[model samples]
Target: MFSGGGSHACFRDCVEGVAMTCTYNFTITASTAMSYLCGDCPNNVSACSNPSCIAAGGIVRPVTVVNNRIPGPGIQVN
Candidate 1:
């Protein structure tokens, strides 16, 4: 599933000899905001900043690669 923001999905022409037109749509729910929320360390320690750190007894914090970003990267038919 995509993020709250919008994403661009392209349908490229394939050598299979088929049409390359595509269309897609979806709804963004309120939870989208929570999805990217950054949680801080338990004691506000800088060491434990993200969830990844918490795995090692660090902290629990939500992190977003790019705030307000959606769809992530891209896909090529090559």
Candidate 2:
């Protein structure tokens, strides 16, 4: 997954061939944001100082990546 946020993360169980084409987009006004794939996420995530932070409190939500099995055999298997 791809994010326009300050930071991002990605975990690959198997990133072969066309799997790389898969992408996700997100917008974060927060100063610090995180992305996790396969549940592997950072321990700390800093919240934004913008007005949005005040409204939602000092809590930044990390983006989660859920990958489904590809219909066809992946490069690794092939």
**lDDT (C-alpha, whole model) for all candidates:** 0.38, 0.30
lDDT (tens digit, per residue) of candidate 2 on 1-78: 323223323334555564544445333332323322212222323332222222122234533222211121122322
Task: State the number of backbone clashes in model 2.
Answer: 0
Expressed as tens digits, the lDDT of each residue in 1-78 for candidate 1 is 343313443543455765566544433322222222335544556634554332223333343433223333344454
lDDT of 1: 0.38
RMSD of each: 9.3, 14.5
Best by lDDT: 1
Per-residue error for 29 in candidate 2, Å, reads 1.9
